[model samples]
Target: MSEQKKAEKIVGVKGMNDILPADAPLWELFENTVHSVLKSYGFQQIRTPIVEPTALFARGLGAVTDIVEKEMYSFTDSMNGDQLTLRPENTAGVVRAALEHNLTYDGPKRLWYVGPMFRHERPQRGRYRQFHQVGAEAVGFTGPDVDAELIMMCQRLWDDLGLSDIRLELNSIGNAEERNKHRVDLIAYFEQHKELLDTDAQRRLHANPLRILDTKNPTMQEMVNAAPKLLDYLGEESRAHFEGVQKILNHNNIPFTINPRLVRGMDYYNRTVFEWVTDQLGSQGTVCGGGRYDPLIEMFGGKPTPACGFAMGVERILELMKASGEQYAPNQCDVYVVHQGEAAQLQSFVLAERLRTAGLDVVLHCASANGGGSFKAQMKRADGSGAAFAVIIGEDEVTANTAVVKHLRAEEGAEQNQVSVEFDAVVDYVVDQIVGHGHDHDHDHDHVHYHP
Candidate 1:
């Protein structure tokens, strides 16, 4: 007989990360805060499929944009020969859904979404190939008030999250006509200093000249700085719209700076544009970015309707939260039920469910640690679970019809943290101490017996 070769072990895909148990608390807290804030503002939730037709991005985010050109995870469906792509950004998908469903046929809508967005870029801190975003869209809204409201909404969330270091940068890219005129002059001016442009800049020079203004290349800084400013070209209507947003933000006491070079990555945005940026994050990347895109509905083959929205990188915001010194105690559950022996195990299981029924999160210990049947080992696991209290049951207590509840996180030998209650009163006692329960319950059950 010949020995067989072992197969290699497979791991998760590169750049796509697993949110392990240790990191889930922070994510949950952030998500809850976002949901509450968005709901308070009357924004309903909207979910769209992760994959869409390849042409959606090509048309929505101009074909010449960097995302469409270099970063999208696109492929052809072999079975049906249909070109498909994992969405790089969600605004396009949202609009596609709105148009397809005629969701706005009656009136405008305020919507939000949170999900993973795929991109094929090289991953780094706070940026990933499979990243998550929380975004909002106000469709059929034509005024600058909605834009300012969206900005204020973000400010409120930051305040609630105890984040004070992030700052807002505001800008206006004007309408297509205004940008078109500026585009011609921009190309002419860049052409005059052709040698100073970087590879990315030169490639986008004619197709997406506005993006060239946002280049990070230090070599092209001087020329890009002096290039035609978009603000200078804003017409009367566009200038007023920009001023309207500023006026509202000023009234609301939300401070902001007008960064004339703040052109966002998307091609759909027009009129009002703003970004919440943080210097705390390395190199001052945008935490959230959005603007008014009044032409997107028409672009998606629907009636011309105005829309405004913003998307925030979840990984980046969570990084900022992690830096704020906010502590998340390792909380596995509210109650950990540890037991020994067959009789004690049966009692522990019943008590665990009763605690759960009383609205307490409970974890019943399994006899698998160390000796797989020792009280000391089970207690050790209970103490390490970060649970607030441990309910210990043993052969003696199973016979006595009582359980000893000990506080897991208390100082050693602190009698106040430890208490013993009748097995019937265990659930009520834990509920009252943990969350101040108001309901009353009675237990009238027989005990389990073991014979070997």
Candidate 2:
């Protein structure tokens, strides 16, 4: 008989990654920093589903936009024949939820969210098919102060994260009326330079003329630079709103540049738009970007509400952190309980729980089928666990109601010593030595630690 063929090994889907034990600490640190900063500004957390009606995004983001036209993971529901999409961006879903629940009917709300978003795009260094974002939204407020405050909040986050390279790029797209006038002029100019327009630019010319200004094509740079500026078409009210936002940022010492070509890709944005960009990440430089989208809530069938928000790519920010030499050390327990013999094993388990109850993290070594291994092997495992102290239990110690405590992590020039402690005194001894003595055995830090 012929030999049977082997099946192929399974792996994670492309561009979707798993956060392994080694890399989880950095993600936790980033999340903690974001939560603390958001809490400081009275922003509450809001969670929305990862899937929503396909029309939500098609309406929120323009149908011609890349996300809706190309990148979204959309499918037809088998049970009901409904069209559903894995959210490529979160702003639309958030607005849909707010409208569904009438969250802003009474007043304004400051909401934030952190979760994974899916987009079927070509994966690169910082961009992925499945990536995470930390977003903040201010709903039912129509003033420039909220816009400026959101920008300032982002600045505060960067400062807290020890990031110094990111800079702010600001712009104003005006309301629909002003944008219409500019759009007409912009389309006329693109028609004049039709020969120089690239395929992407030409395609976006009639659909989303404003996005043409953000083209990176070297050949079309000169033409795009000379296109009609949105800043010039701002009416009195729009200009004042733009100026109001700038004044607050200026007074707060937040330096920014007014970039006429910084129109964001979303169709919902209007009046004010800003991006926190950096030179570190190649090609994909905008780490965080958002702006005012006052018409979105009303468009979603809710009473007219003013809103603005922003979202930062978590993977990109974490990459920047790693590049800047930021370290997030893994959390380690304070004590590892090593045991031998049946009686000693039972006693080790009991004592480990006691130590844990006393606000200490303990790792109890379980007995193996191979005669529970040797004492040297168990001690090696204890040391490898990064514990500052190891509690040894044997038949003799179990009988005497005592444990042999060995100091595994010792300071420079300090002697590594072992001491005998009664079972009743073990918890206090471990706590005092680890916490009171400042041995730094506990991997406790002000920031969050990731658990796998």
Candidate 3:
């Protein structure tokens, strides 16, 4: 016999994590909360392609920014020789879509997105190469009212998610003209302390001197702190715009601190930059970051338009949610249908479909190596499925056209509390019990429970 070649296992790419079943409950909780919170703020969802032109980011995010220079996953397509990149951040892609489709032609539009973004970075807690972001962009809005509204919306989400200790820090980088003047002093100041500037800082000295102020190099901290604060250079109009956002936030009782060193990774952000930071998550403490990018639409070949948005890291927030000590059950389905015998198997399928038709999640058990597993074995699988109810059918029940409903989540050591119902009445009986149980827990505090 010829030698057989062995097959080797191929694993997922590093830093691209799989959302295993065990962790899915927490992810579902976070996503559902986000959808509800965004909808409350009148923001509608917008989805864009994962791949966009390489030049879009090069021109939009500034070629010198770390995201464009080091982090972006860009390549030239072999098929058509078109330069493409998996988006590192979604703001640019969102703006490109809006411009291409004239989405804002009618008037201003509020859009939101939730999807994965690609970035090549050392993976660690709360960060990955393939990470998900839930962002909201208010396009064509020209005032600080929207700015404050977006921040308030974030606070509402944190509150709803039972998160605490995440604080907001704000600053204004000023308009292009104002930033130019600050850039001048920032370069000169860093030039004096050239020895203190790291290799990255030295390279960015003239090209992007402002970003050095955001450096985490401990050696350069003292010098960078003394570098010109952008807030000191804000023009009267920029100052007024920043104050307007603050006035609204203060009135709404959203507390924040002014961090002069707070700067965004992108060059597009002009004024009113802010970050929601936390003591947790180690060095990657920024849970969310965003700012007003008034000039971006014009830069994208659209008319002069004002826009502001924010994106929160889904993994990071989930980590915080875990720390909050909330528990979640991995509910695969609401009802698990277990059957034995040929006739019971067919009847189980029919009953499952009917339950689903009534808007209930149902799981129908199938025979394994042990054909028509004893009722004992099938019931074990049902208990492990995280199902609240189990519909048991055997040859006897098939003959009688009845199903035994077993309460799966009943109190510890409590009776199974099995109920026998006709096949025609199974759907109504299951739904009434589920719905009535919810009402008792939510409203009827004095409701009595039936025990064996």
Note the residue pairs that clash in candidate 2: none
**lDDT minimum window of 10 residues, candidate 1:** 443-452
Q: lDDT of candidate 1 vs native?
A: 0.87
| Stronger candidate by lDDT (2 vs 3) | 2
Q: Which segments of model 1 are wrong by more than 4 Å?
A: 1-4, 369-372, 411-413, 435-452
The superposed Cα distance between candidate 2 and the true structure at residue 59, in angstroms, equals: 1.1
| Order of models, best lDDT first | 2, 3, 1
lDDT of 3 at 260: 96
In the range 124-143, model 2's lDDT, one tens digit per residue, is 99999999999999998889
Q: How many backbone clashes does candidate 3 have?
A: 0
lDDT of 1 by residue, 65-182 (tens): 8789999999999999999999999999999999999999889999999999999988888778899999999999988999999999999999999998999999999999999999
Give the better candidate number (1 or 3) by lDDT: 3
Q: Candidate 3 at residue 76, lDDT?
A: 93
- If scored against the real structure, what TM-score would every candidate get? 0.93, 0.94, 0.94
User: Which model, 1 or 2, shows the larger TM-score?
Assistant: 2
Off by over 4 Å in 2: 1-7, 367-372, 412-416, 441-452
Worst ten in a row by lDDT for model 2 = 443-452
Query: Candidate 3 at residue 295, lDDT?
Result: 85
